[model samples]
Target: MRALVLAGGAGTRLRPITSTSAKQLVPVANKPILFYGLEQIRDAGVTEVGIIVGDTAADIEAAVGDGSALGISVTYLRQEAPLGLAHAVLTAADFLGDEDFVMFLGDNLIEGGIGDLVASFERDRPAAQLLLKQVPDPERFGVAVLADDGTIERLVEKPADPPSDLALVGVYLFTSAIVDAARRISPSARGELEITDAIQQLLDDGQTVRASRVEGWWLDTGKKDELLDANRIVLGTVTQRIDGDVDQDSTVTGAVVVEAGAVVTGSVLRGPAVIGADARIVDSYVGPFTSIAEGCVVTRSEVEFSVLMQGCVLTDVPRIEASLLGREVRVSRGARRPAAHRLLLGDHSDVELAEGS
Candidate 1:
């Protein structure tokens, strides 16, 4: 089986950051989110893959070039517009040929990867196998209803009143039979050819559709909050490795990994955190579940549960938590403006100022 990875969506939910970089390129644990999906596909024994790219095509192509670095030969499929998931599949018909394939969303992270899912799909050869997980917000996702035998009975895309709590988890396995379904279905009310509709058509035709409930975490890194959570989940797997310089005045504890060339002095780094290459932290507290990416600098400040992209600088900022800073961002206390709380936030960026401090 081959793989089709979708890296094309305009991650409007991530706004300010996505405005400059593709959402798939957002770093989680200092690694591009797209890279994790590609790695997962490679580990699934799928050697040939096609990536669907849209306006952010250049960035995606530049990062995953020949795909050799990731152990796969990649072909870029141009989706002129994100007509929808079914539209993406329809556009890649020629490349997918008559083989079974897996469609992966580049920004979605599933625990333990898709190796087991691929194995199961090949073993049973279902018409389509979907990854499902129980989520609190079923209305925000494509939901599924299963029959008594555990076969997919119906599918709905962001339904107003969801019938089940099981939401589609952004990973799908399909036989070549799906091509016909994609062509047979019409665009939904949202003006895109919904993949859920195609899957429902398969059920209407009596094709065997199955679902595998995810036993581990499933994260869609399309928003800031979700991105930070994904960082925490991934950071939990890190082993304590201080390849960088940590001065005697600093204390680095538990599950922290400081990359080579990073410097820490007069600071405390609480673990499940990472300091990327060339990053510097001085007289600060790098609290749990935080990631300071390459070339970032943090001094005389404290932060927790946050992610800072490459080249960010934070000095005398006091405290920051549950935040995401884009590359080349600078945050500092200004003697003239900061006592009143000033901000220059971007679209979709959420900020909560200290209460009357």
Candidate 2:
């Protein structure tokens, strides 16, 4: 079986960051979010992969290349616009050909990979199979209704009154039948060919559709909080590995990772946390669930539950938690007497300042 990975959304929800970088490229635990999906696809025994890319095609291509590094041969399928999931499948038709394939959303992270799902799909050979998870807010996702025999009875895309709590989990398995289903459906009210509609079309055409419940976490990293949550969950699984230099003045504890070339001095690193390559943490408290990307510097600061991207600097910052900092972002306290906050943020940036700090 082949794989079609969609890395081409306009990620408006993660604005400012998404404005300059692909959302799929955003790091969770110092690793690109898209990379996790690719790795899972490879682990599922699917090496012939096609990435559906849009405006961020160049960036995704530069990072993924031919996908040989990840044990897959990648073919880039250029989608003219950020249309929809069904549109992405339609765009990758040539690469997918007549084979059964898996469609994975690049920004979605599923724990434990999709090996079992692929195996089940191969064993049963259903016309289409979907991964479904019971979500608190079914209205926020494409939901599914199941029949008595556990077959997918119906599918709805962001319905105001959802039929069930089973939300689509961003991983799909399909035989060639889905291509025609996608073509047969019209654009939804949102002006895109919805994948839910295509799946509904399959049901309407008397094709077998099945769903498997996600036993592990399924994170759709589309917003800031969601991304941070994903980071925390992924970090919790890290094992303690200190490959970098930790001076006697520094104290490290728990499942933390200090990559090679990173230096920690007069600081406390409390894991599950990761200090990326060449990063320096001095006289600071790098708290739990934090990922400091490569070349970053943290001095006399306390950071917890945050993601500091490559080249970010945090100097004399008292405490920062549950935050996401883009590359090269500098957060330093000024020596001015007034002691006021200063911020130069990009479009759609969200910041909360403490008064009288």
Candidate 3:
């Protein structure tokens, strides 16, 4: 089977960060979110992959290239706009071409991979198979209603009164029939062709629609808090590997990873945390669930549960927690006559300042 990965959405929810960089490229555990999906698709034994790209097409292409590095041959399909999930599938029709395939959202992180889901789909050959997870806020997602035999009976996209708690996970398996289903559906009230409508079309046409419960975590990294949560979860799985230099004045504990060329001096690194290549940590405390990307510098600062992207510099910043810093962001203590907070925040940037520190 082949794979159709959607990396095209303009992540408005992530704002400032997504304004400059693709949301799919956001790092979780110092790895791009999209990379995890690609790796899972590869692990599921599907090498022929088509990636859907939109405004951030160039960035996605630069990071993924031909996908040969990940042992998959990638074909880039450009979508004219950020239409919808069904629209993405329609855009990939040429590459998908009458073959069964899996559609995965690039910014989502699903635990345990999609190997078993692929195996099941290949065996059942359902018209469409969706991965569902029980979520408290079903209204926030495309929800499904199941029959007595566990087959998917009805699907709704962001219903005000959801029929069930089974929210659609980002991973989906489909036969070629879905192409027609997508074409048969009209755009929703939101002016986008909803995938739920396409799948509902299959059910209306007497085609089998199946669902598998997600037994593990499923994270959609579209917002700040959600991204941070994903980072924390992924960091929990890291194993200690000190490939970089940890000076005699430094102390490392727990599952910390110091990548080659990174230097830690007079600091405390408490894992599960990762200090990326060429990053320097001096006279600071790098706490758990944190990922400091390559070429970043942290001196006389204390950062915990935060994600700092490449080339960030944090100097004399007393504390930072549960934060996401974009590339080359500099946070330093200023020596001024009067103490006050200074910020040059971007659009939709959220910051909570501690008063009188």
Candidate 4:
């Protein structure tokens, strides 16, 4: 089966960062989230891949190149707008042709890969196979109702009252029959072609649609919390490989990976953390679940459980935890003499300040 990876959405939920970069290109453990999906597709023996690109097409293209780096040949398919999932499928119809394909959301992360899922599809294929996971907030996802025979009966896109806890995972396997279903379906109230509606059309056409529960973690890194959580989970699997310079005064512990050219002096790096290439950490504590991207700097500061993009500078910043910072940001301790609140905040932003500061 061919692979159709949709990387063409406006990630408005991850603003400031998404304002400058593509969400799929965001690094989880120093590797782009899109690369993870591509690696898994390669492992599944899919050689021909089509990537759907939107406004961030240039960034995605630059990062992924010709897909030779991922052991697959890629064809860039442009989407005029961020319509919807089924819309993306329609856009890729020419590339998909008559072959069965796997539709992977570029920003989704599924732990342990989809090797077995592809194997199952190759053995006994269905008209459409959806990956399902039990989520607490099914109302926020595409809800699926299953028949007694473990087949999909109905699907709803973000219903106010969900029928079941089973939510559709971002990865879907579909046959060429889905192309007809997508074409037959109408756009939902959201003004976009809903994949759930397309799948329901398959059911209406007397086609067999199946659901398979995900055995491992599945993450849709749409917002800040989800992004950081995915980062933490991915970092847990990273093996220790220190290719950088760490002074004798520095203490690097646990599963930390310091990439080449990175320097750590008089710093304490905790486990499951990575200091990217050319990054510098001096007299700082780089705690767990944190990724300091390439060329970032941290001096006399402490950070934990955060993802710092490339070229960020943190000097005497005291302590920052559970945060996501964009590239080229500089956070420094303000002058004590000023004793004023100088702020430029975004919409719905929350800030806390010490008394008398």
Residue range with the least summed lDDT across 10 consecutive positions in model 3: 348-357
Name every residue pair that clashes in candidate 1.
none
- Candidate 4: the clashing residue pairs are none
The TM-score measured for candidate 2 stands at: 0.99
Model 1 over residues 1-357: C-alpha lDDT tens digits? 999999999999998899988999999999999999999999999989999999999999999999999999999999989899999999899999999999999999999989999999999999999999999999999999999999899999999999999999999999999999999999999999999999999998899999999999999998899999999999999999999999999998899999999999999999999999999999999999999999999999999999999999998989999999999999988788435667787777767777775
Question: Each candidate: what lDDT?
Answer: 0.94, 0.95, 0.96, 0.92
- Worst 10 contiguous positions by lDDT, candidate 4: 348-357
Instruction: Tell me how far the alpha carbon of residue 180 in candidate 2 is from the true structure, in angstroms, after superposition.
Output: 0.8
Instruction: Give candidate 4's total backbone clashes.
Output: 0
What TM-scores do the predictions have? 0.97, 0.99, 0.99, 0.97
Q: Write the per-residue lDDT of candidate 3 for residues 31-56, one digit (tens) a residue.
A: 99999999999999999999999989
Quality of model 2 by C-alpha lDDT: 0.95
Evaluate candidate 3 by giving its C-alpha RMSD to the native, one decimal: 0.7
The TM-score, computed over Cα atoms with residue i paired to residue i, of candidate 1 is: 0.97
Candidate 3 is scored at a TM of 0.99
Model 2 lDDT-worst window of ten:
337-346
